[model samples]
Target chain A: MTGNVRLTQVARRWDAIIIGSGAGGGVVAWSLAFQGMEVLVIERGHHVPFSPPDRDHLRNHRLTQYGHNVGPSLDDRRGMTTGDDPTSATWHSPLEWQYNNNAMGVGGGTSVYGAQAWRFKPEDFRMASIYGVPEGSSLADWPISYADLEPHYIEMERELGVAGGRGGTQTWPMPPTAPTVKGQRLAAAAGRLGWDTQAVPLAVNSVPYNDRPACVNCQHCVGFACPVDAKNGSQNTFLPRAMETGNVTLITDAQVVHIESAGEKVTGVRVVQRGKSMVIPTDRVIVAAGAIETARLLLVSQIGNQNDQVGRNLQGHYYASAAGITPESVYDGVGPGPSVATTRWSHGNDGIIGGGMLADDFVLLPIIYAKRALPPHAPTWGDEWKNFVRDNYRRTLQVMGPIQDIPSPTSRVLVSPTETDAVGMPRVVLSGTAHPESVRAQTFLLGKAKQWLAEAGAEQIWGSPSGQYLSAGQHQAGTCRMGEDPRTSVVDPSGKIHGYANIWVADTSVHVTNGGFNPFLTAMATAIRTSSLIS
Target chain B: MPIDAHLVPILRAATARIVPTDDLPGAAELRATEFILGFPEYADSYNAGLAKLPADFDLSTPDAQDSALSQLSSDDPHFFDLLRRQTIEAVLAQPSALWDAMGFVVTA
Candidate 1:
């Protein structure tokens, strides 16, 4: 991490070029710039302007069947493979299913994220050690321990202006939003079920912070940009801090197609800007595109492939849900939903190596509610479906979260030899599903959610069906996993690729496990910790 | 949504079966078929999937329609699932007198 170049190379020329201005890259850019180092952040998506269209229930980021609110139109598809056979299926499949979950914009996923900020438990850092690595599962321990990341986690929470503390305490920077009516009922129900239901820390402004107004209960919270600027995404937090430093230049709509590297070093990146190809030279490069894209980029670059572990061990949460017909109307219609959560099952479930935190679900948009919420095999059409929804939309409560995934080397991202992107870079091929134990844990946790909902006055309860499709989507992680051993990992504990001097990864891509909770806060914390050691 | 002139009957029958008029106003009353037909983005898939049944297959009665839907779903889960989802969505998306009838209320 040592290179003292002349100021001539620092004029809008990046000292450190970060690809993808999402949570991880955002923190990294701001951290470097705060240290007075010139940094250039490149984002492949637009700086989406928040407008009324963002409130479109059917077309927003959460429900993309009709259209996408994040700018990549339905036609803007990416190449990917299916199942475990990269050679079987081509990239012509729908992007919604195959490209893995990613929001294309300056804020990246943070723009429309539900903002569930969470820290992985101590056991999450040592999966294989706590419970021996099961055969056929590529699960292993993280190089860095949770103790090593504790300070950074707190730092990330304070910097991002999160709201929440244990048992709804207001000890943090901002008081947690009063648990929604849904939250209260769920908390009581979880308590009755003997689960530790508590307030969740959210990367949302509960009170005015940094001059942004508090949440207005905008119903379109999860997949839409905050109209009042109450949500503290990387766009509102680190991106501005980086910009205000006067040492960072954020270039949006600049898609990097290649990382030009020669003999154990990355020289610069080849980007397509405004339909023009340009090269930005830099001594340091941090690829935080995403778990999927970062792995794809590394594999495409043909560097960081010493052990061929670049795109292996791709992991994401096996998200499962349980919904109940609450006797009372729990539909508060507040913007961000399911503020109450129980981490009791996050660990110590019998015979289960991993577990997930169960929380009330987000404020379901009308269309999203129609798509989900209801029990399985509920009528898809007709009097039964319509009457059920009409009767239950207000009476429904969903409890769900991401289940920790066991990594599998076979389920991975690879360079597609045939399918190429618009820039001629070979597209990513991905396949795999959650390990059987993770699925078993999902079912176990789902029962708890069902019981909690039932205790909370739900006369009838239903569990969301589980799927075996490669679970990697929005909570995608571990593609370019971090470990002390270079043979098994792409990046080291410092996030630098093994044996590489300046090339590093700081996003969920470096996650050893996706964790029971949301992974965004951990990704930001990793960025904070990694940037502190960059120089 | 502008109704597909030729596919109107099938769409209406399908929508009726999916959300048939019961004690309440149903799919036809809500114009679910017209709305779903207007969505060209996924209408082709639905049109192609529904076209599998005989042109004159009986869809007038609930039992017959339900049987057809079950068979279609069994034969091609993706198409039937898509059809079911889209039809229900069309019914639920727009303003319907049903909300008032069902005692449904949107809260703040």
Candidate 2:
């Protein structure tokens, strides 16, 4: 039976109620459900159909001009203020870049993501201990180390059917997919620079795993749904498995409005389903909404902020990208273009604070390439622009990395004092920029990317500098950080919210320091560890 | 709002100016006007923007049309930018002769 149940049909009380159904919440739901507990997972958006998938070139997640594939829609609005200037506040739709949204559907970002499942290095867990705290930053070491989550990472990788090179006990269940011509070329260049390259770990299938088909190597791999259902996400893996246990109920298009609490204990959650509001009772409440919304939910409920630590220290990866024109045609129109990566710059770079891993970018659709990968002096339109695109479409290559940003407490999400969304809910106001050390780290990574491209026999190289804008977007994390002290953090090492027994956070919201690579795998591993400790 | 039938030619001419024909097919050859009309919001914006073009824009020379577009870009940047972006998107969306010439393969 489909777990998509109507509110009237579900039980009045659930053993555990999980908010949001992305990487974090999905894992928690599966963990708790397999333990014979009734789990209710509420998502704010509906399930997007896999068949007749959205193929609009202009409106897909890659380029949201008209709109995005998965949506909070234009009805959702956020107030954006830059650098502590309330007067600079401007309202933007989720379609706009300033809104910095992940997908809003039942699978959340996992539904439309590229499925890059990277594990953070051991140094990532000890950012403060390894590099010392940068001035004017809120950088801290995670209470739980990498060794604590290593076993969970291996388990989640197998569950998600990840494909990568084999290692010791942390081996991938599936072999890495064949490298594309661009990936091979970039790997050779990294070799010349005395750096080792490895196949990027991806939560996608090389052969049929968990009964899903292998990748067909289609051009439309990233930012779009897989036609073959090959890209494994929480939507296909954990959520369905949890449903099969008959203990997990999924309610889509259910917007959680408030948390009903009695002093220090969370009693239930108030949700708006199809325009009607109702409170569903639960013994335990696990908030796994993405970083921004998770904090906004607590702020609006006027709980979980006893120490005023609900929505501070917002941080996300700042990507440094460089593009160049290879001497020969490097792009062979292969799918899932990002197959090679170098972790040489991920850590231990001389004179740099925390660095990041460099990898070949995902397949670029024609429109995205034309807009983002064109030469610096190329025209935006007309015959010259069209001609340039036709000539370089097959020879252009780009390398980018997501630098580990130094978290600043000032870069935060707050309930706007004067703005509200279409539903009359308090709008979230994002303010402040990243720490200066983050920019230095990004610049260093950009230099390495350019060097890699130049070594690959490229001509006419150009790069984009990381801007001073707030860095919380697809990989957003570190809003409600976990620590032993309630005065400095929102949750404990086990993801239990401080001062509350039954309320917990199992998402990136509990991250003290998001790693230098994609954070989804880390988020899932932590989710499993957190759910295991739940009584 | 529906695009006025009389201004349809103006919309086609504007898209052509953005992606003019060289050795390969351009926006007009790829049926960009039809694709643009499929998007109701984009079509309405095109309807309003195309109505402001000079009456002889559809009959103008290639150079004259380019000049007019450059003027429109300065006069109404938002409309011109929307038209330009949509034209490129429409041309790329279809598996037209341009994709073949550029070696961009679309697969299932």
Candidate 3:
């Protein structure tokens, strides 16, 4: 185990082999190791430590190009075309797609997420119970209820050092020492508007907890590494702790190709590392690659093909924002994530047709913000535009909302026949559209944002134009949904894949419905629950 | 003291509009222009670009200020853009108390 052992050398079987190192796999590895079970964790991304002494900010930014820094230019991987018409871009070509927000590293999406850890409201788990599914919607109730996962949410909050007050005036188990000033401002604004805005419960530390340092307010938390180890990503919390157990082994840079199964049971997994492909035996296996890749992995492996539920029901949230030039400066470079949030639109009430949360804009550097500017009735370049940037670069503020997408059976991830990745795996083909309800939600939130800016004393407000092609945000969920019925679901209540006792899924893919709030907290909670069940 | 030699008056105007004078000193006293101009990330290109300016032009005067900005604006919009952008960024990058005076929270 100590040397650079190939898969051939490590032919001995293991108790468990986890396919990801994010929230789900990290939790399972820790729990199994604690139970004295041998666990081997395979992560496709590298283990990047926080603020390495010789860290080149430029190089790191390049590696993480989907973020604000100059990096490998990302092509939209969403709309892949199938036919070989000369004009059509290949379905697998990375060059054709638009913007990609998903992060690919050891911590998965959690490493660069905004860390808005919100639990799915009680109504979310029972979607069929509350709102009857409309025609053309694949909505259904989750196998497990929020009540069943409540304690696990609490456990996740405690373990991840989530800082916020609790729901409905109920006190948090561990209260934050002090709310960030941005959170305070948002709370004040929400109070004035008569909307229930709460301090966003974040999986980031306000004070040193569980051996991690307190947040230093670098104002670069979202989409960037915490120079100080305060954010509760898997790398910062679970994975390292799991390694300390001595019962768990982590193999980085190992890309799993497929599961080598005998009939129904997975005997081992075939993986490629450094130009060699080999199989490592295991008694059980878990796939936690994430919503998009998890489904792609299953389709590639040809496992769970009977029901064809593995890669269906793709869902992701769409974000819309309205910004304006205020008479005053609202740019205070402190923490980087959204600190305050309003759940007024979280339910389809108040004349709003869909669900969402209104929150302040994440902190943006001037260069980043300039690129995002879209002034009404102005050319993208020229003297007027230069003047516009000069005049309003500092005097602008934004209010944004994330609209929840209704899961659709037709929207899915399929293997692209035309293209392949660096490792020869078929490229992931993503096909989906913004749900109509989600579009309506964006419209309502944009109007609300305009009103909020006016109330905040903005001189000239500019609302985003209504559009159909709303892109995905940090919230991507519900591909391999959970349900009591095996026909419609991929996993059971405890996240074990249907028809396979030892195969499990521990990622956002298991989300039955995309919750109104950020989904990271729910992911962590699910991980904790899955671990408890395995124990 | 006279305005810092590297500080453009337009930059001063933009910074004043962003965080106007109050109990706290404005961007001028903070030496924001000097900071942006001197930072290594921009120094080489900025110096070479600014070398095109006339040797004895008094940018403090309104006409000179307009002329200099217009010329710089046309040659490289990004440079002039950075001038306005960096001023606000420098002001926002200051301590939290300064930000609070300018109607902004330290976090969010």
Per-residue CA lDDT of model 3 for A37-121, tens digit only, reads: 8888887766555664222222233123112331112432443433222124333223221323455567776766677777778
TM-score of chain A of 2: 0.97
Whose lDDT is greatest here? Answer: 2
Evaluated with TM-score, which candidate comes out highest?
2
Better of 1 and 3 by DockQ: 1
- lDDT per residue for candidate 1 within A1-535, as digits (tens), equals 1122322333344679999989899999989998988888888887766653355666667776666677454544554455555556544433363345578788789988889888889999998998888878988999899999999998888989888855532256787776788888877777777777677778889888988888877666788888877888888889888888788877776778999988888889988765677777898999999898899888888878899798888887777688878776777677577588888888878898788888887777556777766777666665566777777888888888877888888778877777666667776777766678878888888887777877888888887547666776668888888888888988888889887788889799999888998999999999889999897
For lDDT, candidate 2 versus 3, the one ahead is 2
User: Considering TM-score, which of the candidate structures 2 and 3 is the better prediction for this target?
Assistant: 2
What is candidate 3's DockQ? 0.06
Show the lowest summed lDDT stretch of 10 residues, model 1 chain A: A1-10
Model 3 CA lDDT for position A201: 75
Q: Per-candidate TM vs. native? A: 0.90, 0.95, 0.78
Candidate DockQ scores, in order: 0.39, 0.64, 0.06
Docking class of 1: acceptable
Steric clashes per prediction: 6, 0, 3
- Could you give the candidate ranking by TM-score, starting with the highest? 2, 1, 3
Candidate 2: RMSD to truth: 2.3
- Give me the runs in candidate 1 sitting further than 4 Å from their true place: A1-12, A71-85, A92-99, A168-170, B1-4, B9-34, B41-81, B94-108
Better of 1 and 2 by TM-score: 2
lDDT of each: 0.78, 0.85, 0.66
